[model samples]
Target: MSDTKNKWHAIALVAGILLIAVNLRVPFTSIAPVLPLIQNAFGLSASALGLLTSLPLLAFAAFSPLSASVARRFGIERTLFGALLVISAGILLRSAGSAWALYAGTILIGTGIALANVLLPGLIKRDFSTKMASMTGAYSITMGAAGAVGSAVIVPLTQSWGWPIALSLLVAAPLLALVVWLPQLKKHEHVNLSGPKQAPTVAVWRSPLAWQVTLFMGLNAMPFYVAVGWLPTILMDHGISPEQAGTVHGTLQLTTAIPGLILAATLRRLKDQKLAAATVSLLTASSLIGLIYAPDYAMLWAAFLGFGSGASMMLGLTFIGLRTKNAGDTAALSGMVQCVGYLMAAAGPLLLGQLHDWTGGWTAPLLITAAISVAGAFTGMLAGRNVQLEHAESSSRTSPAIQSANALTAGERKR
Candidate 1:
């Protein structure tokens, strides 16, 4: 009976995580397809429209560093639940059809996602410690899939039901995630609200390996986000119609989930992911070359890029769990990596656009992407090195008596 009950608990936990993962990208992605309609309705200029798209990323960089600390104080489950509420509120607020409401809601949505983004890896570390790679794959795949679906559906939904109803439709996801996650509130109640403070450790800013992971994350994101932002425009410049370009872009996003699903099914751990990283870099480079030179085969090149992008992101996320020894370090490293990494990624689209305007072609921008891919490969190799953070290392050195005492205290807190 106890074993069966544990299985049910695991099921609930997995459901909650997967549901939460789906919400992480949908709020942002669902806006893009109907952006022109939104701009028209608001009588907004190009700069205002651009700001709508960029605000979430800025919010990510601004709010991510605070998430780990918030989780530490409030408990991960409660923090994530609160994040879901924030997302739901943001979705409704953005759908209010006013410019201020739109920007405020977008910021709120970004803030909510940033917290979930930093905290989910830590939660996985705490709960699915043994199956890190597989569970990470599940969440990562769900995130990619949600983005694809959002991009695919939003335009049609807006045409049929109007923008407010269409955008508001997304609130259901977080609301469902909130409902599924309620079981965790009971678990949270068992957790003590406070703990004895420990000596402050040096920040992750001082760690070389953490920097490597952050670079790997940031570099991979640059090409992926750039592709997401401009690939359709690139395709259109090659003589494809807007509708066809949209189709290709959607296909590219859906393709990203393939490698994650395969990884989840086949391999969950790697001593060194250097070879995998190299594979991603090569695929991305080749895809970029194909996109620049062979517009007729855009679908095929996009498939390769999507596969590579998905794998790189999956590897980056996996490292968060593989490289950390405990949940606290996982949370800290996640915050540091995502906070800096996304700030860097947020610049990708703007820079790519500038390159295109300067050279009057897609070649220069893609060449930049190729270079970033090679750098990503190098960073991936460094981050793939089997190592743990300094705090985890020090913590591991504690005497068995002290370790036992700490475990007892943790167990008491559970009671």
Candidate 2:
């Protein structure tokens, strides 16, 4: 009976993690399809819309560095559960009433997501050591798919149910995630994951390789966020209807998922991911070129961009796990990478939006995006090299409690 119960608990834990992952991006992406509607309703300009879209990302940048410390203080499982509740609250508050409510809710959402995003990679590193890539892929697929579906359906839902209610519907995801995550807090109540009393800290900001990974993550994210915030608008500019544009936007997101699924299968055999990273960047660049020069074939460009962006996202996450030997290091690197990376990412939509407003067209902005893709490709090549972050001449200390817990976890995983 004991063994059976433990087995069931393990299954539930995995289910819960996936559930939480799905909630991470839905709140952010759901707003994209209805962006134009919201802008018109609120009487917002292009630059104002960009700020609205980027408000969460700016929150992500600001809050990311605090997540690891917050997790350390509160316990990772409990922290994650709290984050879900916060996300739910943010979603509710976002639709509560005025423009201020919406902006305030978005900041709350970003804060919650920041906590989840930085901590999850470390949790996955700690728990699913052997199947890192596959697990990352699983969660990435869930996240990407949810975002796409949300984007696809939001506009139509707005048409039928109205924008505020349509946006409010997203609260259900985090609420469900919160319920599923409760079991984990109970299971891990006794486990001590807080690091050594005098833990050695690596200056991730100083490490060349860390910077490479951070740059790759940041650069790819810039284009990805830019596309999410404004790609439908760009398509609409090319004469596509709003409904069809939403569908195409959704399709682009779905395309991103395919590489994740494919790579999950092949990751076990793959030791080096540099080529994969380069390929993803190249595909995104090509897509941008197509979008700029061949506006008539926007769907094809969207597909290419989706495939690259999706694959790069997975690879960026996988790099975090692969480059760390333990959970603490994972957390530290995750925090650093996301903090600086997201700060850089926050510039994407804002700058592009301003550029569009100034130039009165998409050409300059698209060219800038293409340049970003090239930069991402270069950084990906450097970041994807087979190297671990702990070997960067940084001292590492492990507490006996952590080591014991790891041993026990490893033994159970073998079962």
Candidate 3:
């Protein structure tokens, strides 16, 4: 009976994690499908619309690094609960029919998402250390599926009801997540109170391996976001109808969810991820090349691009847990990785757009993204090594007590 109870508890935790993941991407993706309605509602300029879209990425960059410390001070479960409330509030505020509320709400939503993004890997590391890869893949799939659903439904809902009503409906997911996650607070409260008193002393920013992981993830993000922002326009420019281009875009997003299922089943069987990383990078580059040379095969290229991006992202998240010694270090490394990675992602679309303007063509921008994907293959090779960040010489500067604590935690995890 005790064993059965424990198993059910573990299952509940996994459900909670996946439920939170459902909220991670839907809010942001829901906006794109209804952008025109929003713009018209507020009489906003094109620049304002761009800023509205970019605000979330900016908030992610600004708030990501700060999440670890906040989690350290407040328990992770409580912090996440607070984040869901913030997300719900943001959704409501954004739909309140005002421009200031819209921007403020977006920033709030982004800030809440930043906290969740930085902390979830560490939560998995703490609770599901042995099953890190599978758990990462599961949550990645959940996020991708939720985003796809949000994109698909928002336009139809907006047309039927109104933009504000359509947008405000997103609050339901986070509210449900909050209900599903409530039990975790009680379960984790004791652990949080009794866990190591001293925070991680190893500086993730000072470690070379951490930098390699950051760059690998950052480069992967560049091409993925570039495509997300520009692929439909590129397709239309190549003579595809708007409806066909939109279908291809949907295909890209739907296919992204496929890789997480594959990786969840296969990632743990491998000794290291170097080859997997390189393969995904090559797929990304090949897809971009196909897009440039064979515009007629846009659907195939989009599918390939989606699979490559999805796999690369799942690997990057997995690396956060695999490369760290403990949950604290996982949070620290996650913070550093996402802070830099998302900033690069924010810049990617803008830079590609500028390049397109300067060259008066999509070829140059696509080529540049392809080159970055090729570079990511090399960086991924370095990051995919079967090594932990704590073992690095630069990370060895922790005090004797901290070292002993880490060793004890590592031993506990191993057992």
Best by lDDT: 2
How close to the true structure is residue 269 of candidate 3, measured as C-alpha lDDT?
Answer: 97
Report every candidate's CA lDDT.
0.80, 0.82, 0.82
Error of 2 at 79 (Å): 1.8
Deviation in angstroms for 273 in model 2? Answer: 5.1
Question: Where is model 2 more than 4 Å wrong at Cα?
Answer: 125-132, 188-204, 264-275, 318-334, 384-415
Better of 2 and 3 by TM-score: 2
Residue 298's lDDT in candidate 2: 84
The lDDT, on a scale of 0 to 1, for candidate 2 is 0.82
TM accuracy, model 2: 0.83
Q: List the lowest-lDDT window of 10 residues for candidate 1.
A: 189-198
User: Which stretches in model 3 have alpha-carbon errors above 4 Å?
Assistant: 1-15, 36-51, 72-74, 124-135, 182-209, 229-247, 264-273, 292-296, 318-334, 356-361, 384-415
In model 1, state the lDDT of residue 402: 91
Expressed as tens digits, the lDDT of each residue in 194-307 for candidate 3 is: 256445545788888899899999999888877765676678778976456656766677778898777866988989999998899889999999999999999999899999
RMSD of 3: 7.8
Ten residues in sequence with the least summed lDDT for candidate 2: 191-200
lDDT per residue (tens digit) for residues 67-109 in model 1: 7678777888999999999999999999997889988999999
Error of 2 at 270 (Å): 6.9
What is the per-residue lDDT of model 2 for residues 1-415, given as tens digits with 9 covering 90 to 100? Answer: 9999989987987898898898788998778877777888888778888887898899888877777778777878988998898898899998886888888998899889988987787788878889887887788778878887888888888889988999999988998888878778864443334445333255576677778888899899888888888898888888888788887787787787788778766765777888888889988988988888897788888888998887887788778878777766676677677777788788899988899899999999989998998999999889888887654453344557777888899999999
